[model samples]
Target chain A: MTFFINSVYFGMVLTFVAYEIGLFCKKKIRLAIVNPVVIASLIVGAVLVLGKIDYETYSESVQYITYFLTPATVCLAIPLYRQIHLLKKYPLAIMGGVFSGVLTAMVSIYFIALIFGLTHEQYITLLPKSITTAIGMGISEKMGGIVTLTVVAISVTGITGTLSAEFMLKLFRIKNPVAKGLAIGTCSHALGTTKAMEMGEVEGAMSSLAIVLTGILTVIGVSIFANFIG
Target chain B: MKYLKQLAIVLIVSLLAELMAYLIPLPVAASVYGLVLMLIGLITHIIPLRLVEDVGDFLVENMGIMFVPPTVGIIACVDELKQMWIPLLVAGIFTTFLIMIITGLVTQALIKKTGGES
Candidate 1:
């Protein structure tokens, strides 16, 4: 029992268990707000605190899990491949929306951080908060931002995106499936894509395309913005 | 055995991407490098779609589960995060809506102008 508790199995098991609980809650509530990542992290986090488990120990035990993040990101290409025809269909419209969305996400975060009196470090940390984990982590690290802070910010950003996107769509009267998918995926990454998937297959595929395009655009946007700022 | 082969293909592509990122002076993420490389390979038929379809689908479909552990890292900096909770929450919530509305509206208009489906 002690051996199982100390091994990588411990963290992996804990994560899976917590995630299952999250899924259960989502099914019960039928609310997008009940995001599995949020629920799992909160449950697992509280458990770690209550049990006196250090973050370092927990992360170390789950280190292999983190390694999968890279390959998982690579797998994102498959969806984009399957839906490449979408790119061919509406190249200009897709690029216009994705580029604009990526810029708005970062720029708004920067201005908001400034208006709210956040330090430059905090601003940088929040820069890539809307992108997927793999690309977001890479952008944050490359731009001298804190990975932990970016991860947390991304989670919050994702949760917010997931929960409020539908309302925003109605409020803005966005009726186009392509536009809806592009907006959600561009603004909130994969988490928003889940909601988009619920909307329809075309929405889901378009959102998947936006997720990859937004990531690529955001990386370039951050690099160019960094140069300008420096 | 099939799963292992698929995993190997992904890892190898990721490895090559890592090498590319190292050799290049740009700060592009290795994952992006890998993604682009895999994308080109697929488009060119150099890498068959079936080769990694199962593994790829499984990974992307369950990608959110992978983010949980890293996000739990926030526990270590709760105090520091607490100091800026208002700004953090406000910024996160506000920007999400802002981006969604703006992106959605702009795309909607453009698509309308282009004479596309709703």
Candidate 2:
């Protein structure tokens, strides 16, 4: 038993199993809140806590899975490439929408943190909340924010986008597929992109493009905004 | 064989992107550089899409699972989360809705103004 728990495969197996369970729940429940990543994280967290296993032991092996995050992020270019024509066609709209979205995300979080009297560390942590975890994590770490808190905040932001995107789009009477995708991706990154993909191919493509652009824009944006609290 | 070849290309591109990121003094993540390089490669025909499409698709499709470990780190910050839950929740939920609405409205309005497809 000890040997099995200490093996390199332990964490990988745990993560894969938890994720599969999460996928199963999503399939069965068919609810946006039944997020696979969230569920898997909860299950894995519970195991680490309840089993008296420290996070380091579990994460050492699980790091292998995260090793793919960078490569996976790079592969986002494929979808963006497939949708390059849309970018050319609506360059102004897409670029404008993503820029404003990134701006709103940063500015709004700043004010919210100020109103709530959050410390600078907390403020910076939430600054990159709306982007994908891969990019958001790096920004948070660099800005001296708590990386784990940033991860939680990002997941919360994503789940909120996934949960509310369709209703929000409909309420706003946002009928354009491109706009729908851009909005979701800009606000929630790839998690919301999943919802956009279900909306339509164009929405999915546009959403993926928004993810890349929003990430780049936020990288530039945060450097400037980190000084706001300092 | 095909998948292996495709995986190799992606790994190489990712490695090169990491190298570039290391050499460049910027706040940008290596993943961002990798994505940009891949886009440039596809656009210029320097690296054909077919060379990495299958593996790329697989990676993107299963991307969410990759975040699990990092998120599980939240356990380490339980006390901070307890202290900051309210602000975090308000900021997260409120700003998310605000960004979606504002961004969607702006994009939709711009598309109309630019006379693109409605």
Candidate 3:
């Protein structure tokens, strides 16, 4: 029993099972709010709690999955590389869009977090919330924020972006695929890219480009500008 | 064999990037180093895109799944979230739109100014 419980496969199987369940629901419900990660985390969290399995034990067994995160993030370079033509064609537009996204995210998060009276750790955790979890978690760690909070915040931001994407696009009267995709990807990261893909091929590609660029910009911004926020 | 080879190529690149990030004093994320280096290699033809395309596509396609496990870390922060749910939700919802609107507007304005399309 001990061997089975501690075996890496134990946690791996649990996560896969939980994710499949989440996928099933996502297909049936067709709702962005029913995000696979959110659902999987809830089920996995419940299992660990009910089974009296500690967080440390669960995380330890699932170390392999976490390790893949670094490579998966690196793989994002593939999309950026593929979209290099767009970069050359409208370099200023793309960079300008991403810059605005990063600046707005940081300034808004800073003020909102302060207005809500968040602690320094909470503020820092949320500082990188607009970027993907992989990069956001790194920024959170470097800035002395709670990694867990940052991850959760990023997930919430992604879900919000996915759910409200259409409304926001219509509200903004954004017609350009480049603009639309960049906005979605910058605000919500990969999940928003999924939505952008649904809109059209060009939107998908632009969003893919936006995700990488926004990740880079946000990392630079948080590392340098975080000191000014407090 | 094909998949393994592709995966190995990406793994090596990632490992090298991680090593370089460690040696460098910059505060950038190691994964960003891996990404930038990989991009440079691909553009310069040092690493052909096809070599890692299969495994890279596979990983990017399933990236969401990989993120699930780390999110379980949220369980550890449940109490903190409970205490701050309102502000957290407001911050998330408000700022998400703020970024979206600002980015979209900026991109559109730039495109119009550059004479691409109105």
Candidate 4:
């Protein structure tokens, strides 16, 4: 009973606190690493680890909240809706770029893991890392990979994308927001998108565009490869 | 009636995607199939934006919080994963990092060629 109550409170509190903290950090630190979700996730994850609380009890208590995930995913249409203009304006270019990027990202990692002699399950676990954390975690679970490992991987990749993106843009002299956004969303997923949005409207739209394209491309690429390997 | 349609579409997409996964043997799973399926519906106009606009709008705004339960999965499987820490750690970081770099570079090049916006 206590666990149930604690779990509910924990979820609610984490969301509120994390969002506020994240917003505050964004205003104060232009650096992108201070994202609310990342900050909150780390702190909350740490607390969970240290709490000695059972995950089952906690999840069961807060399952009501978690169920919102599916609907939440469907909600991505909002941003896409706003950016339909971007899609309309540069449909061919955006799709072509994003699809190719998605292909390169997934195949490159899949092969590297393959060469590393990682098991099938391990490969599946990391397959969705370039996607958002929610989707990535779910795919990881289904593919028989560690969900926690996948989440952590998602966060790290997001942070890496957020932190290193500017350096990357400058290093490679990538000037276009669409290119930058698509690149980040394809490689880093949500975290990268967050940073891309911070850079500008064009970057944000392009990043959002990349998310859709890469998600589709990766799906196709993964399916094709799954056939060849199996 | 409206909510039911929304939920049903989500389910249909999930099943269709999963079926595709089974037949295609992709490393990815069915739910992801569901995501791609929806994306296609939007792209090809199989499902009009109005049909899912409200529901999809809701899903995106709250996408951040979706990982809570799954992250909670950490506690459930930590024991099994703990035993394989080295492999999981190495594979997780290396594969993720490699994908990030390659995807970033490739997408950058693609955008340049596509010639839309800078």
Error of 2 at A191 (Å): 3.1
- Computed on alpha carbons, the lDDT of every model, listed in order, comes to 0.79, 0.87, 0.81, 0.61
Q: Which tens-of-lDDT digit does each residue in A25-124 have in candidate 4?
A: 7689976456666665566666566766666655665576666654444444445555667776666666666666666556655675666676666666
Which regions of candidate 2 fall more than 4 Å away from where they truly are?
A: none
Worst 10 residues of 4 chain B by lDDT: B25-34
TM-score of each: 0.89, 0.92, 0.87, 0.70
Clashing pairs in 3: none
Provide a comma-separated list of chain B TM-scores, one per candidate: 0.86, 0.89, 0.86, 0.67
Question: What range of 10 consecutive residues in model 2 chain B has the weakest lDDT sum?
Answer: B24-33
DockQ of each: 0.58, 0.69, 0.61, 0.27
C-alpha displacement of A210 in model 1, angstroms?
2.7
Chain B TM-score of candidate 2 stands at 0.89
DockQ of 2: 0.69
By descending TM-score, how would the candidates be arranged? 2, 1, 3, 4
List candidate 1 segments past 4 Å from native: A1-4, A141-144, A197-201, A223-230, B116-118
Comparing only chain A of model 1 with the true chain A, what is the TM-score? 0.85
In terms of DockQ, which candidate is stronger, 1 or 2? 2
Candidate 2 CAPRI classification by DockQ? medium
